[model samples]
Target: MAVTCDLSAERFVDRWSDYVGAPPLTCGIVDVGERTRPTVSGVDPDRVRTVSDPGNLQHLHDAVETHLSELPDADRTVVYLDTVNALLDHVPIPSVTGFLDRLTSSLSALGAVSCASFETGERGERTIRPVTETFGTVFELGRLGRSLEPTDDQLSSDDVFEVLSSRSQRLVLRSLLRAEGTLHVRELAQRIAAAQTTEQPDIEQIVTRLHHIDLPKLRETGLVAVEDRVVSATEVVTEVEPYLALAHPDERN
Candidate 1:
């Protein structure tokens, strides 16, 4: 099940479709801030519920409860809630946190996975501190790899050598930097393959190597962020840029 307040239902599916996969039974979505229920792909229209009034917490809870009632296999189910930022516009911070606490506790009892998103700021932190106490794990999204302040401590010299050791990895970082630090794995492969080989770069082979080999190395070193097959460059890339040239076969020690 998905509950969207700031995020559109369609966009949520797009981002999470890979992980969400197909459920054994019918699923549902409660979209707040939409006047009419929008068509969501791979879902029955009847299952898509909408609330025009963002302040209607009861309606939101009822919609979620209705969906929970439909699916019996709680262990395999996932409940996703988008942006707490939008929900706060209508509900007070205390009420919002209380709602999340109750919602997560209920899902926990059923053994279903519960996840939610929140923006970054003083308000977000204040709300999330209480919310995090309810949820088991928290992921810092939107800016994991990209730090506003680039520092040398984020990446070690050994990590630098290892990540830039590969021609493909070097190509990956250069390409990502040029693309403004983010690209899907396939697109990143296409760009690198096209650069290294004049003949049509074997995209599948390149993609496989990146997945199994190059990307992990870069990701481990904090030089890149890999999520749902999307690779993003962290600010650490700026520190490593100069060394990429010296790591070339001709310049290597």
Candidate 2:
């Protein structure tokens, strides 16, 4: 079952087909909104259930719950929520998050795979930060592909400067570049402190800061990736590396 907030059921199926190949014949679309939009030619009308108002969360939940109760193979089912951004316009973050938490819990108990999409932007990011904690796994898909790596045209000079402004961040990029793009947090922290000529580096403190601040900023900019206490540099870091010196000219001398 899929709950679509941003696009019509047919459009969502079209995107799903494009991304993951043709959706199953058993696929169900719980489209949220009116039927003013024309349906696609090939999509099945019986498979789609629409709630006229996007703000009608109860109706949407009832639609999905009714669908779930009828499913014979719960394990084969996949629940998709194509976006939370549109819903946020109608409901508060807490309500949307609460609904998601409940839905995901129910889906998990049924052995169903749950997937959701949330757009990224200043406002979207604020909502996603908290919502992300609800899901067990999160995948970030860029405009091009699964890689969060931004293309040259996507990143401007100021964007690069903003990311590389911190001395610790610059050092991190340099170290990752030298290490062939991957290092454990402890090793990465040691390398960072070593570059600063710290004789007695507090490794734990450095690691804590990286976990909380530096790594997240770099990951957000697509300059690096952090997973399981390991940090890896992305192509963006290598591409904008020369500008690192210019970002902090004092570091050069």
Candidate 3:
């Protein structure tokens, strides 16, 4: 089952279409937010439910209870909950923590794994300490390695796909991956524009876009680092390298 907190089902599918398309999910999707019904059209889930009042924890509990009661016996199931941090918007930190405790416990009893995400700065370090301690595992994003090579701490397929969603970001990543070391922002911009097949690549426009959009995104995803006037790829680029190849099977890596 997919439990969307602040995220919509359409956005989720956009990021995980590769997994959702294959092995077609004969599953359920729960939309929990302002919208009382499914926000994305053309996706009629077999068993779907929605909890519109995000501020009402009781409403959320009731929705999950209905879902749990309807689910058939299975050895394994997974619950994906995006925007765990968004709960903080409606409830107190202690309340949200308690809610997660009960939810995770319920999933565990059902033999289902709970995969949740939390945005940084939604809660302070002190507030987050107990919350992080509750989870079995936690992943701290944005720490980059020296080289753009695969590592034990590789990103998940979901993370990789999310990063690849933006074409401009992908262009920046590929440029960084090919470079031996740091590349000046201007040099990187020229290459990206050149790849667009423009006879006169606009260096100024490309620089502006990278500075305002692409570079910030790459940094947020930990795919690349921007320092001074230069950029460099990180270990994440290597993890995504395979997917890029699959995306363009005709081209050699």
Q: Best-fitting candidate, measured by TM-score?
A: 2
Off by over 4 Å in 3: 18-24, 39-46, 143-253
Q: Backbone clashes per model, in order?
A: 0, 0, 0
Scored against the true structure, residue 5 in model 3 reaches a CA lDDT of 79
lDDT of 3 by residue, 72-166 (tens): 66336777778777678888878878887888887777777776777765468977787776676566555452333435676655667777786
Query: What residue pairs are clashing in model 2?
Result: none
lDDT score, candidate 3, position 203: 86
Please give the lDDT score at residue 154 for candidate 3. Answer: 64
Give the Å shift of residue 216 in candidate 1: 28
RMSD of each: 15.4, 12.5, 15.7
> Which pairs of residues collide in candidate 1?
none
lDDT of 1 at 217: 83
TM-score of candidate 1 to 2 decimals: 0.52
Which stretches in model 1 have alpha-carbon errors above 4 Å? 15-26, 122-125, 142-253
Displacement of the residue 113 alpha carbon in candidate 1, Å: 1.3
